[model samples]
Target: MTSTQVPATPARVTAGPALTSAGLVTVLLGAALPLIDFFIVNIALPAIGSDLRTSSATLELVVAAYGIAYAVLLVVGGRLGDAFGRRKLFLIGLTAFTFTSLLCGIAPTALTLVLARAAQGAAAALMLPQVLSIIQAATTGERRSKALGLYGATAGLSMVLGQFLGGALVAADLWGTGWRPIFLVNVPVGIVGLVVARRLIPESRSRNPIGIDRPGTVFLAIALVSLLLPLAEGPVLDWPLWTIALLVVFPFAAAGFVHVERRMERRGGVPLLPPSVMRMPSVRQGLLVGVPFFIGFSAFMFVFAVTLQDGLHLGPFGSGLVTAPLSLAFFAMCLVSSRLVTRFGQRVVAAGLSVQLLGLLVLIGTVLLEWPNLGVLDFAPGMLLCGLGQGLAMTTVFRIVLSKVSPEIAGVGSGMLTTSQQAAMALGVATLGTLFASAGAGPLGMKGAFALVIGIQAVLTVGVITVARRLPDPRL
Candidate 1:
């Protein structure tokens, strides 16, 4: 409500120029890059470790730094896009992401790579929220619904493909670059996105914009780092005293963050994450639906990659090939998910979760029976079913979550959604990943650990199914 702030609702944003076919494709493509990069480093970890001579803790830092930085800055990025221009930030983010990727590609030390990865993540945070905000602002009615469906599908698929592509790229070694190619590949891709997006992607931003919430931003960063950092490093560092201290501090930090944001709103100022936005039934329920799924989804990918490499004795390309069924099935199901929602309503999500449960059971059976003999054929049936379910479940959930958010706050809402997702992924690595690591170290071995994690994921999915049933009617 400050005099300097733009009106809370602007006509230009509400009546945004129609996004062309090419424009939609360009933004969607841009959205996929950051997501893909998040997981693409998974399958390449072993090669990275060998080449960089880094310890397990250092490798985890490589992932954790990027994830933490990304999640922490996400809402702020969205706020900036709204205050400035979505198109301007998108180009800046892409350019910085490319440079950081290059820095990662040529890093001579593990420390340098981690630093560069953190910067790359910040750039991604800046770029991603605009994807949803633009779609929300530019498209309408059926067009908006379809675009959201496609965006959700793209988001979910990118995570899966990241690992597969990482494996393939590392295995290919493209002139003996080995694991470096995984990061280097983004350089060209980012450049292409820049060129296309500048021309095709329509510029859109919030009409009523507010200044940066510096206090809220700092507190949010503190809260996220406190929770995620310890979870990420505790097991690797043998649960040190400092990690314990950070864990003890998390609840307080999180509470303070909420208090600060609420205070800002009470003072008639927009906070980094508006309390009112969080108060929305759809936003809260949406997080409930998204958090567990992403946690399981992320942990599953990392553990699966480790199992394929260390337990099943698959090479990088072999592991990548093994996941081909999962990726293809997900992509296929996503293509039809919007239509399925029209026919089946939100029950598609419940049904999808049910399918996921069955798939997990199938996977348990396969693991118990096949053990070390597991291969593409052995894993394909369960992988296909799981992918199909996730494809439907994720796309529909995203639609429901953002369905109620008005264009006035589209940027913040989108940032919040993606932030929860990225944070959940990091938590997945911290929790289930740690559990798997421990189980493997114990007498049960890697195979037992993998089975245990999948069972846990099944239970998590079942819990999510109950929540999915409670999702407001998509027609709303």
Candidate 2:
């Protein structure tokens, strides 16, 4: 099958409510694991460090290694799913993720846990792309919008809940286990997800299949690793000379990857990211906006965790509870997103950013007002606004970015968008996280450091709004 010979519409399977509902649940379950894993370890990090006697730098690697591997492989994962069957890849990846989660739970040492986390990330790369691809191939228009909205909601809620759940599990020491429950809990959930997915998730593949772009895949992976690894681990490791050199080499490698991809396109070969899609103005702008949005969002979460724990002297559970308002607001706004998008179009995104900015400012004001007296309750007003803003903007952006994509290229397109998001998220933790850490170490302390972080995030939010303005209204 070739691009020109591809059908105008995606080839349909016999989809009914039962199958669709089950599929959605399956994908949502798959989506939840990676995100949950991302933050679940955060609250547990202190526990793990104390238990294993690991340094802050090594512990950072425990997080960074997984993120870097996951971000690097995600595109190839999507392409592989296109070549094979999505259901097949989904099942395999889920099984791998579950097993790796177990490995993470039982690992005897810090080094082993880090390796297991990296494996878990690799498994996530295989599973995550299939969620969007399945939705793309299976649904259209309003139904598609709603599904995407749920995905956004799930993504946000999982980040918040992961912290809470991790905290609770660690505190509970279920089975006399401490932080291990964070990973161990996934065992039962994975079993249920796998069984349901096998029964309900229909196998779907690109009707117009293209051979794997092996060269493109390799170069892209190298380019991503070169860029992401340094950013994520550089500051934590005291900005080593090797990290600087890798960062310097990243752009050239990325350019070469693009050049090779273009050549492949001209020669009628498959490229991991098709040049044609990259040429679309909407796609280009949407990606531009997505990068900053994700970067700021991820960085904020990281900084918040550190601030609550290290700055305010809160325990894991307290920190998690503080974020409850944000999670609740996100859920509430997500429920109304489809209608809001319909009524407001791209402006809804702009409004969301504005609201988010307001929320941040309010939060900043509260921090300034209370200073040393500030606690989780003091954060409620700003958090509610921030949550609402994030929900509105992020979900709207998800819808806009994929608006022009068709089902044939859905896997690659979704891959392109998500890869940008994951890369930005990793960089966010690396760059902004470094800034916060450095500032906190200075005479300024944690409050000043948090204020600086939130200020930068606000600036990024402004950038997102500016880029979003250039996007076509009503999506397509």
Candidate 3:
């Protein structure tokens, strides 16, 4: 049905109990794939490198390629969903993602794996935005909040579980598959999701949908690719001249894309990003705040994993165990996020930042105090606090940013928010991760490198608090 035409309330006949339950599970399954893929490959990276004789540089590409491509195309993916049908795009994206996962599992060379990962990222861009849009359009008020809470919980849990699951799968070497199980495992999950989705999820789309803004899409893609590619690859290659050149062009390309979008909107044409949404203070501010937070978060996860595995002589499962407290705390906080947001308003976010900063400081202290004696148990308390802070800040931002958005613009709004998040995450890994890697090479070693990284995170936390002050007190 068109977005404007609300469907009749489901009767017992059309949406059977089994079908309804299947629909919810299908969307959750869809959401789980992209997140699961992200962290799952991380733990499996060392194994893949050993088995394939791939260098560290190429392995980085395997991870970064997927993130960069996914970040760049998310907005376009959302617009496609609005123009065609969310269900249609979702199905196509899911099928492509499933096939690509197979390709990644069977890849004979590092280059092939990287290329397949890029395609997988593109498919994820198309698939993920539709999940939120579908949920938003299909539910209202309290039900919406509940669905979003579930999503937040799933996201947090999946990231941690991805690591553990990857470790277990690799260790198990199911049928002598070794690291290949990381990708191969998705086959069954995707198949189940597809079958359930086809039988259950109803079709949805915008009425009076605008034609694709081809020029804007092209420029935006170029802008994002130019910006993300260099950062992700520059460190691996030790900052090549071409990488520097791309960095210089990114801003200009981004500006040109914005100008074209504005012109299109003025001429009574629908732009990929509607101008009105940009005008909303809540949306703009939330995005600005989200960038730094996600950047810090993504960088922290990447750096920590590497430090634990490489510097501390821990295995994949050990590294995953080290981070388990953070995930557990995050999940616990998210469960109460709705109530907290309702009671404390935006103050909860500010408090979260403050708490996170404290946690970082404590962790840093432990690093400095214990030095070479530090182990996963010693890190647990601080990591749990960090996770709590993250839960409060990130989940609150997700709700506050989208709370004011209209259902008509839901697809693009979700795209914009998610793209900002993904872009910031990639940037985090590139910038802060680079800093950690570089510092580790010096006399300070891993401890010194970690201290520097946490210092940066502390600074970002302060920025979050400052931004939180500027937001509406009671929140929406």
Candidate 4:
């Protein structure tokens, strides 16, 4: 090990030299790509459905497939990055993501697009964890804090920007491509990222690399699939026998995963995720706050997109334009989030959540008042408030979650955080989406459905504040 590197573990110390400005930008670009893709399809789903002749059930798969695959394989992807070089994995993943995106752009049918999207998600899983692990390995102290804050900024901006970008691309209909350009646009960006990353990014890997945990990986996959499959497919399929069976299987599969992981730990081997990591007070409590926050955030994005286009009769570009103020607000706040954290400690997250609830209340009131007569301007105030709140909460929560992670397990820690966030996002689409659909189709109509979903999100935002109170103070 290099004498200059910090001592992180008995076997593997942090390997890379301090990150340069160019290297930091490369990794942040890599981080932005996957997050942007996660929501990029939200504003394009209608176009995809019309062009591909897909039913609503199949349309849901188009989104759910990417999120599920991404969530399921993330930890394993991290383990691979640790065993191999992180830079190598990052390159491979970016290449594969580029190819799969091309596949998605050229997909001949709805099923083909769905399958390609899942492949794209798998590529994202392999790529995304390395960004964080590399930062943890290559930077320290103030540099690490700045890098993390940029990552947070990148992440927040990407989610909001995805919808905007998708809308503009779909409306542009480049060469009459319509919805296809959203996926295709990544190809050029991926190519540029690859060139920049290879030149600027340093290669790093764990010194004491362990074998993959085959049993643990299998059990974890089963548990996630069993749980996510039912929630995503149940409403679409009318709660069929298979969905019920999978739901029943989920608990047992989860228990088996926990048992196997513990057994692996006792035998002096690294499991996919060591129980000790989850047992950490900061890690555990921080994830609790993240779940409800992401769930509400993602659901709001999905439902609002559909409502804006289908119910309110706005075009894709018009719908996306409505969110411009939110995106602007989020971007501006993310730039200042590090300063906010320095000043307020963990209270920033609480304050953010409180503001988000206030914004939701504003949105609910606006919907009730304007209803069928709503315009893009009507959503401006509430969306701006929500964005500011999200920026404050999202950036700081990421800091809090990884605050105590040592460099030795940076890959696994990054994987765990991403996995939790992705899982919650997929669940949000399933549960809240189903609620929206069911209630809309009922006598309550679209207006009532929108009201209920926003109300539920407000409740979830409150849950975030409750959990935030339990987090160890970041300033400490």
**Residue 215's lDDT in candidate 1:** 85
State residue 282's C-alpha deviation in candidate 1, in Å: 3.3
Angstrom error at residue 174, model 4:
2.2
Please report the TM-score between candidate 4 and the true structure: 0.91
Clashing pairs in 4: none
TM-score of each: 0.90, 0.88, 0.89, 0.91
Model 4 per-residue lDDT tens digits across residues 59-108: 66787778778877777676688788888998998999999999999999
Regions of model 4 farther than 4 Å from truth: 1-23, 136-148
Please give, for residues 1-476, the per-residue lDDT of candidate 3 as tens digits.
Answer: 00000111111111112224457678877878888888878777778877899755566667767877786677767667766777788898899899999999999999899999999998987887677666655666677677766766777777667868876887778898888989988888888788878878777765555466788778777887687777766876788999999999999998998899899989987666667777788887877777898888877877776677677767777777777888778778878877899998878888888889989999899888987777879999899899899888888887777778775555556656666677677677667876776778889898899999989999988988899877664454
Each model's lDDT: 0.78, 0.76, 0.75, 0.80
Ranked candidates, highest lDDT first? 4, 1, 2, 3
Candidate 1 segments whose C-alpha is farther than 4 A from its true place = 1-24, 55-57, 134-150, 156-164, 199-202
Give model 1's TM-score versus the native structure.
0.90
Off by over 4 Å in 3: 1-19, 49-58, 136-148, 274-276, 474-476
Give per-residue CA lDDT, model 1, range 1-476, as digits (tens): 00000112222354568888789998887788877876678777667777899755566667767877887787777777877888888898889888999999999998999899889888877887677778777899999988876776675578567757887898888998888988998999989989998888777776676677888778877887788778767887899999999999899988998999899999988676677987788878877988899888878877887788768878787888777777778778878888888888778889998998898899989998888887878889898898888878877777777678886565566556666777777778778877887788889999899899999999999899998888876765
Candidate 3 worst ten-residue window by lDDT: 1-10
Rank order (by TM-score, best first)? 4, 1, 3, 2
Q: How much is the lDDT of residue 384 in candidate 3?
A: 88
